[model samples]
Every structure is written in structure tokens, then in C-alpha cells.
Target: MEKISVFLDDYRKAPDGYVLAETMDECISLLYSFDIEHLSLDHDLLHKTRNGFMLVQLMIKEKLFAKRITIHSANSVGGKAMYNLLKQAQRDLILSDSTIVSLRPLPLHFFPANVMKHYLEVI
Candidate 1:
């Protein structure tokens, strides 16, 4: 099976080989439909009802996640919240072994320098 990668953001463009999901609904739909290997998220979608944080919450509730998750948002509070929630969910999944997990690291070349630096500095 072909492993997919999803990028969720309203303004930023997805890197090559990634599917762009500009809204919560689109992200959810893609998650349900694909065998996603990696997911890059951004908060503050310019909409009150839908955003990256909501997507993380929904993923936790539904027990769905990509093998690797990256929070690329510049919003400190919302980014941290999403990261924490996803980390918790990932830990739970690992403890329970309820889903298949990938141990492989993501290819870092796809990430921009600023995004990587920001994420590294935050965590």
C-alpha cells in the first residue's frame, strides 16, 4: 500500500507528495480515506469553527492518527495544546497497542528550515 502524507493549513502550501487539507472537514475526510504516514498541522485557520486544534481533538476522540505528527503552527498556545493532545493520544495508543504504529522517522527534507527550527525550539 502507498503511504500518504497530509498537510493541514489554510495559507501555507503542502510540500511535494503531501495532500493539502485546508479545513477540519477536509483533514478528517483524508484521514479516514488514506493510509497516512505523516501529518503536518497548523493552527488558526482563520475560522472560528475549524482549525488544527480541533483536528487533533477529533483524532484523539476517534483514535485516528498518522504515524508521525508535526505541529507547524506559529501560534504558541494553540500549537502547544495540539502537540500535547496528540502526544497524549500517541502514548495511549502505544500503551494499548490498539493501532499499528510506525517507528521510522519522517524525512526531514520536506520541512522548511524555519518550521523545523521553531518546532525544535518549542519542544
Candidate 2:
């Protein structure tokens, strides 16, 4: 089976070769349905029931994680919290040092448009 990449964001376009999930439920469903190789998450989904932070918590509790994960959230506080939680989960799970995981907060100017386009084109 070919593992896929997941991009979880409400208002951004997914990168090439990645599947997009606009809501926390959709993200969780995709995670359950696919063997995710890479996962990029975003916080603050306008008026959603759950956000990226919730997804990270679920992933940790269920012991479900991608081979590589990235947080591309613009919300600094939430993004940092998510990053911390994921790092803790990685430690608890004893993921290898080879695993590629990171928190990449985009600049304040990049949101819902330019940054998404740039990242989609580059990645």
C-alpha cells in the first residue's frame, strides 16, 4: 500500500501529492483511513467543532501518528501547544531519531492565500 500525505487546514490548499482535510473530523477520518506518511496541520478553522490541537491530542491518545508531521499554523500559541504535545508523544512512543517532525509557523503575513499557494507550489 502506498502511504499518503495529509494536509489539514480549513482555508489553505494542500501541497502536491497531499490529501486535504478542512475540518478536524475530516482529518481524523483521513488518518483512520490511510497510512499517512506525512501530515501537515493548521490551527484555527474559523468556526469548527475541533481544531488542530484536538487532532494532535487524539493522535497521541490513539497512538496514531504519521511517519513525519509538521505544524504549519499561524496561531502562535496554539501552534506551540500542538508542537509541544506532538514532541511529547514522540518521546513517549520512542520514535526513532530518524523521524522527521517539526513545527513551522508561517509569518503573520502568510495566511489563507499567498503562503498556501507558495507552499503548495514548492512542496
Candidate 3:
């Protein structure tokens, strides 16, 4: 079966065409076990915890990935910082359209139904 890995502390609504993985470990395992075509990350996983960063680094080191990654983070300061960190890693990123793109080439994409479809087709 096709799988999409998600690095998150909680399981909320999936933005269509994606699946959810409860923990970072589960996310990685899914990537190792299935054809993960996409990934979704939540920035403030535990507010003060750096699990989000750790998960991304692990994926980078393991070379486990989907074709694209999207961030569904809180629109808070910490969230932006976390998003920035991911961009520095040079991962292809998708962000909500409300956010302004500061980093180049990483692809700050928008969310919601239509934009998501466009992103899937483009990437």
C-alpha cells in the first residue's frame, strides 16, 4: 500500500491525499516500510521539545523521504523558527499560503484543497 509519513505528536485531520503517523519513530518506520510519496510536519510538536528538528535530521541522515514535505505548524514565533530550521536543511517545503516566502528554492507553498492539488501536480 502507498504511505505518507507524518512527523507529529498528534493525529489531526489530514489535508487529503496524505496519511498520518503518530510519532516520529512511526513516521520513519513508515518511510522505511512503504512508498511514502509525501510528508507533513507540525512545528510545535510539544512546544518546548525539539522533536520536530530531530525527526527531520533523522530523515535526512537515513535518506528516507517522500517526493515532497509540507509543514502544518502553528502560526506562532516558535513555529516560524522551526520552519526556518527545516528550510536551512534544504528540504522541499510546503507552507500555508498565508506565510510569506523568505527562503528561496525551498518552495514555500500554500495549503487548503485547491492549492494542495496544485502542489501535488507541480512537485
Candidate 4:
């Protein structure tokens, strides 16, 4: 299987070498279609309700997993929820033990889009 990196967010363009999915559905499609090497996600998507947490829930239910998952939402509460869900899934043995789950929140507002890129890279 071909390995790919996925960046899931609504307002920010993906970093270099990543395929961008602006919505949860698109991101889910990518997860099912590809061997995801790195999957970075934001909690608040274009659709308020169909956010990254829902996608994470579906992933847990379907056993759809990436090698590495990062919660990159600026919304600390939402991002923490998603991150905790993944970790809980891992603890419950639903997600792979080897799958790396990380949280690298980015402020996705009140700044140029490039700021996200720098924020991701810098911290």
C-alpha cells in the first residue's frame, strides 16, 4: 500500500507533502483509501457538527487507523477530547498500540495561514 500523509482542516492548507482534506468526510475517505503515515486533524471543520471528534469516533468504530495521528485543533477542549478518545481507544485495544497519538494545537484564526505552518514546525 502506498503511504500518504493527510492534513484535515478547513481553513489552513496542508503542509508540504501532505494531502489536505477540508472536511471530515473527505478525511475519512482518505483514511479508508490510503495507508496513512501521518494524519493531522483539526476539531472544528467546515461543518460545525461533523467535526474531527466524529471522524475519530468513526475511525475507532471501523478500526480505521493511521501510523501516526495528531490533534491539531486550537480549540483545546475539542482537541483534548479527540486526543483522549484516541488514547482511550488504544487503551481499550481498539486502536493499534504502535500508533503514535500526539497533540499539537494550532491557532487557526486572526493570523495569516502561513502562521499555522510555522506553528506546526516550530512547536
Candidate 5:
């Protein structure tokens, strides 16, 4: 499987080395197609009805997950909701026990380069 990084956001331009998915459907397509090494999600999208939160719901319902997942929405409420749900899924054995889930409130403009490196650490 080809390991790839996915960035799901409608507005933010993904930092180098990430496959940018502007919409939930696009993100889901990538989720189904590749071995996602790292998946960073945003809660608020241009299409609120089909935002990152909804993506999280679909991911859980469909058992679609990555090796590592991060909720990087600036919206604290939505980000935490997504993060907590994923954490709960892991706890409940719904998602892979080894899959690391994190809440990182990423800025809309500045994306830390360390984040890409952070996910590459030996688990």
C-alpha cells in the first residue's frame, strides 16, 4: 500500500507533500483509495452540511480510518467534537486500537511543518 498524507479542508492550501481534498466526498475518495499515513481534518468547510464533522461521522460509520488522524479545525467546539468521537471510537474498539487520534487546533494560515514530521515517528 502506498502511504500518503491527506489534508481535508475547503480553504487552507495543504502544506507540501499532502493530498488536498477540498470536500468531504473528495476526502472520502482518497480514504478509500490509499493507505493514509496521516489524515488532518477541518471541521468548518464552505459546505457546512457536509463538513469535517460529517466526514468524521461517515468515517466511523463506514469504518474508514487512517494510521493516524488529527482534528485540526480552528473551530474548537467542532474540532473537539470530532476528536472526542474518534477517541471514543477507539476506546469502544470500533476503530483500530493502534490508530492514533489527536486534536490539534491548526491555524488557517500557518501550518506547522512539524506536524508532518510528527506523524512519521515510530509508533
Candidate 6:
């Protein structure tokens, strides 16, 4: 089986099976080094660097392909802007169409249905 490679920015926020990176460089390097099915980006990434953080820009610029990109951002402005920018980049061939998804907080009893749905649909 091909393992899913995930790049998670925040250690505490990261889900299982993710490789967390503290720096944008490390994150981008991991992104560049492999093909990933999913990526989790935190709003804190923007705090580390402007333009919605370096990793995002790197993914946008390089047009790094992924099955999905989930942004777990608390900052409304940054989150919305990042979502739009990612969409535009994809439209402009700066990113892939199947890449970039906005992650939403689910209820405790939701049973991760949406995540499972995405995974099943992808498979």
C-alpha cells in the first residue's frame, strides 16, 4: 500500500501519520521531496511569514500537486485569502485542480465522517 504522506505545521494540531515541521523551509522541503495526498496548514504559519506563509507560497509557486490541501486556520482573513489565492493559483495553472481543501472544525461526535468521505471518494 502507498502510505499517505502528510505535512503538518503544528505539532499539537497535527493528526496521526503526519510529519510535523517547525519551519517553512522544512515543510516546503518535505513537500518538494514527495508526493502527498493531504496537507494540513495552520494559521500560525502566517504568523511566521507574511503572504500566508512561505510554504503556501512555495506550494502555489511550484504548483506542487496533491490530492487535497486542508487549512486549519483560525484567522478568518488569512484563511479566506489563502483559500481564494489557492483557488486562483489552481485556475491559473499555479496549482493543481485536485489540490487545496479548507479544513473545518467538526463536532466531537461527528465521527470524522467528512474526512472518511474524502478519503473514500479519493480512493
- Best-to-worst ranking by TM-score: 5, 4, 2, 1, 6, 3
* Clashes by residue pair, model 4: none
- The C-alpha TM-scores of every prediction are 0.74, 0.80, 0.58, 0.88, 0.90, 0.70
Ranking by lDDT: 5, 4, 2, 1, 6, 3
Candidate 1 or 3, higher TM-score? Answer: 1
Q: How well is each residue in 1-123 modelled by candidate 4, as lDDT tens digits?
A: 888889999997788889999999999888889999889999998799999999999999999999888898998999999999999999999998889898988766554566545435422
In model 6, the runs with Cα more than 4 Å from the true position are: 1-3, 50-52, 103-123
- TM-score for predicted model 3 compared with the true structure: 0.58
Worst lDDT run of 10 residues, candidate 2, spans 114-123
Question: Which pairs clash in model 5?
Answer: none
Backbone-clash count (model 5): 0
Q: How close is candidate 1 to the true structure, as a TM-score?
A: 0.74
Candidate 1 per-residue lDDT over residues 43-63, each given as its tens digit: 878686688788878888886
Candidate 4 structure, TM-score to reference: 0.88
Candidate RMSDs in order:
6.5, 3.6, 7.5, 3.4, 1.8, 4.0
What are the per-residue Cα lDDT tens digits for candidate 5 across 45-93? Answer: 9897999989999999999999899888999999999999998898989
Angstrom error of the Cα, residue 69, model 2: value is 0.1
Best by TM-score: 5
Distance (Å) between predicted and true CA of 65, model 6? 3.1
User: Scored by CA lDDT, what does every candidate get?
Assistant: 0.69, 0.79, 0.54, 0.87, 0.88, 0.60
Worst 10 residues of 1 by lDDT: 99-108
Per-residue CA lDDT of model 6 for 8-67, tens digit only, reads 444344455667765566667677787777766655653466333456677777776567
- Name the lDDT of candidate 1: 0.69
Candidate 3: the clashing residue pairs are none
lDDT over C-alpha atoms for residue 82 of model 3: 51
Predicted structure 2: clash tally: 0
Best by lDDT: 5
lDDT of 4 at 44: 91
